[model samples]
Target: MSYQHYRLEELARLVQGELVGQADLCLQGLASLELAEPQHIAFVNADKYVEQAKVSKAGALIVTPELQQQLDTHQNFIVVANPYLAFAILTHVFERKHTQTGIESTAQIHPSAIISESAYIGHYVVVGENCVVGDKTIIQSHSKIDDFVEIGKECFIDSHVTITGEAKIADRVRIHANTVIGSEGFGFAPYQGKWHRIAQLGSVQIGNDVRIGSNCSIDRGALDDTILEHGVIIDNLVQIAHNVKVGANTAIAAKCGIAGSTIIGKNCILAGACGVSGHLSIADNVTLTGMSMVTKSISEPGTYSSGTGALPNAQWKRAVIRFRQLADVPLTQLQKRLDHMQTQIESLESTLKLRK
Candidate 1:
């Protein structure tokens, strides 16, 4: 395995940071402050971590301009406005350079499929008829592509993944291992004693820069295509049901399940284990915290949280009992009446003050 080495001056230019160290210093990898070696670079994101930087064995550090005073004078530094962001930029420098492993002989490709000359189709991979695989796209081993599917440029489709239902994926999209795209939605009509199946006729449309993690199931639509706009990131084990439209730049964390026809607006964040019911519209810039269960539509942009955080066992049990007791009471009606009486009393007081 060959690692790419970059000089300090080159890394500084790449991250747009000011280098205050030997320009000729060569770095091979990026590591944490504690684990970094002489050949690797580390980062200090906050002032609180300055003490650790003092003891770190890292050859160089990415630090903000403000932290320069606290950073060790003996250590080399790359100064930037945001140390963490600069560190992220430097990560690309050390990323694995993907060598195009030209199409494997064992791969099965239909004659009608238009696979770019630059694309890499791994062993046992299947490309169906009328499919279009664009430039530099890598479809790893054992992956299956259904008929008429269009995967755009620079996409990465990992091993054992299945893309069916004539899905159209745009540039720079990444579908991790074992994920399924455009699978038939769960549509059924309740008959006398059974469920009659409704054929899912639509497909899926994934925009540019979308990242889908492993084991995710994005169901095809019943009428319209289930869509994921550009810059959308989905974590592992998420279930996106039929006809869902996830807006651009939205991030959905692990174990989330969104039912059919839900439109999640742009810049939204759905934290881990969140569940959104069918037919709900969540406005842009909204955030659903971890373990939240959303049943109603959110019309405004804000951070929303549901479900109780961890509590002591005895207290949680008592809280649960109280909740049950409240369900049995007419507390809502009483509260309304009390609110009306308070309004009346305030009106009387205002009238009395005017007379005085």
Candidate 2:
């Protein structure tokens, strides 16, 4: 009951929508059409949900002009171009404001580090020497910022997150809990029958408006920087190996792993559990379906799916048996059979032409 309240007209103005019906009606929060109460606002995206929106017991509804003409009911409405987008805009209006308590007593910030007065350092957060924390940035409890790191303004560093070994995070970035930035990548040299450790000398450069989810590991480069460009959204449990460069506005789903030195272009979509091998370059506007494995470089932009789709157990068994049998055939014999078939097909085509 203590949440924010807005008039029907005010909510409409926020989303640049046209207001219809009662302007004085107070909307408390947003909800789905089926779950909306009298004080809540609901949104109907498509025409299919127009009936549900009409019957919803909500204070108001956010809808398109096309859907607005269909409703003859007395329910108040806020008409927008995109009802879903309007709902997204209004969510920030009802977001609860958390009070900043300044720097907590247990936070260990170095004297040489430039901590902004507007920033909030939570309990037991460790900030190393020569670090620069910009204004309004919140380093939550149990987080660690290593030496020479720079975090820009209005960034959110969640609890148990580690920004270490030359991490440079830009403005409005959100790194969720337990995520590690600038960790040493998997690089070694085999010398004299032993593996020699190769130091990761480079940093992680994350651009503005990047949102990294929980438990993700972004490894530092062996020489050059590992870059995540602006507006990149990374899901949880993702592993990005050394020197990998991900372009702007790319969305990588959960559990995807990209090996060393790969360059993924802008506006690409990598579905869940997709694995890309080392040193490959993926073109822009490409989409990889779930469980796709890429071993070579992709030069063209298109949706690519690799491996086999799920099938019935009996069908899958038969497919596996056929695949194994094909593997057992000698390469020279297979080529000879293919050549003979091609010659016979050509002869048949010639005979058909003569008869015509």
Candidate 3:
């Protein structure tokens, strides 16, 4: 939790914030309002957290202009247009800098693999033949890079990660531990009462500035490469099936599943635990709320949600029972009754016209 100290004035200037106290106040690290110490800085973004900020022990606070107005005029704080954004910037400054460089002796490198001198290859890492690991990249312990894979500069591949099937990764990508890239997708053909597996011959292409969280699986394509556009961020435990194309700057939350060949447009957000059916096309800037299920293609860009929110167990059981009985309802008889009523209405109208 150690941090390099910075002056209050300098910190405010770095985040484009307005200072309200002594410029020389020494700040060491960032913390939540409840956990902040005398030398730490905290933030209060919304009115709900104002009470907590007022009693916090932090030497300095970062707050929005509206929130600052409610605080004491003499309080030591920094006013920013977006307090959360300012706090995010400070997190980078507080993170510990990595100093390890050079390949570990225990790492296995193939004869045809190209390793950069500045790259850090941790113990037990295997670089396959014809693979290119770019400058300053870090491949942590127990990770395997298969043949012909290309990883760009400044990428971080965490421990126990597997990259195979000629996967191509661009610069500044961060793949967390236990993630499997270019794995075979679920593709089977039914023939003569038996199931046959299809040979997956495609690879995966990841664009720059993408961060994939731990325990996620991104499968390779059946023929073409599965593509992830630049600036994509995927949360933990997500499943991306074969030949799926995720557009630029899309953020997918944890536990989401995208079926094979689905094309998700740019800037879309799929919330946690959502599922998209196979081969569906999702428009750009679409937002699917948590636990949504998409069985059809979305052509318009807007927020979408599905599934009933939380309900009591008793009510949910009754609803499920009602839904199950819908198939038994006699729709043909209902239509016949409606047709008879329409005939009677036409007869009465004719009689009224004759009397007039």
* Highest TM-score against the true fold, candidate: 2
After superposing candidate 1, which stretches have Cα over 4 Å from the reference?
A: 332-356
The digit string of per-residue lDDT tens for model 3 on 1-356 reads 45599998988999999999889999999999999988998988899998888888999999988898887833788899999999999998877866688989999999999999989999999999999999999999999999999999999999999999899999999999999999998899999999999999999999999999999999999999999999999999999999999999999999999999999999999999999999999999999999999999999999999999888999999988887786666889768988999999999999999999
**Candidate 1: worst 10 consecutive residues by lDDT?**
68-77
Task: Please give the ranking of all candidate structures by TM-score, highest first, separated by commas.
Answer: 2, 1, 3
Q: How many steric clashes does model 1 contain?
A: 0
Per-residue lDDT tens digits for candidate 2, residues 1-356, read 57788899999999999999999998889998899899999888898987887788887888888898887664699998899899998898988855594899999999999999999999999999999999999989999999999999999999999998788999999999999999999999999999999999999999999999999999999999999999999999999999999999999999999999999999999999999999999999999999999999999999999999999999999999999999999999999999999999999999999999
- Error in Å for residue 300 of model 1: 0.7
Question: Compared with the true structure, what per-residue lDDT tens digits does model 1 show for residues 271-300?
Answer: 999999999999999999999999999999
List runs of model 2 lying over 4 Å from the truth: 346-356
TM-score of 3: 0.91
RMSD of each: 2.9, 1.8, 3.1
lDDT of each: 0.94, 0.94, 0.94
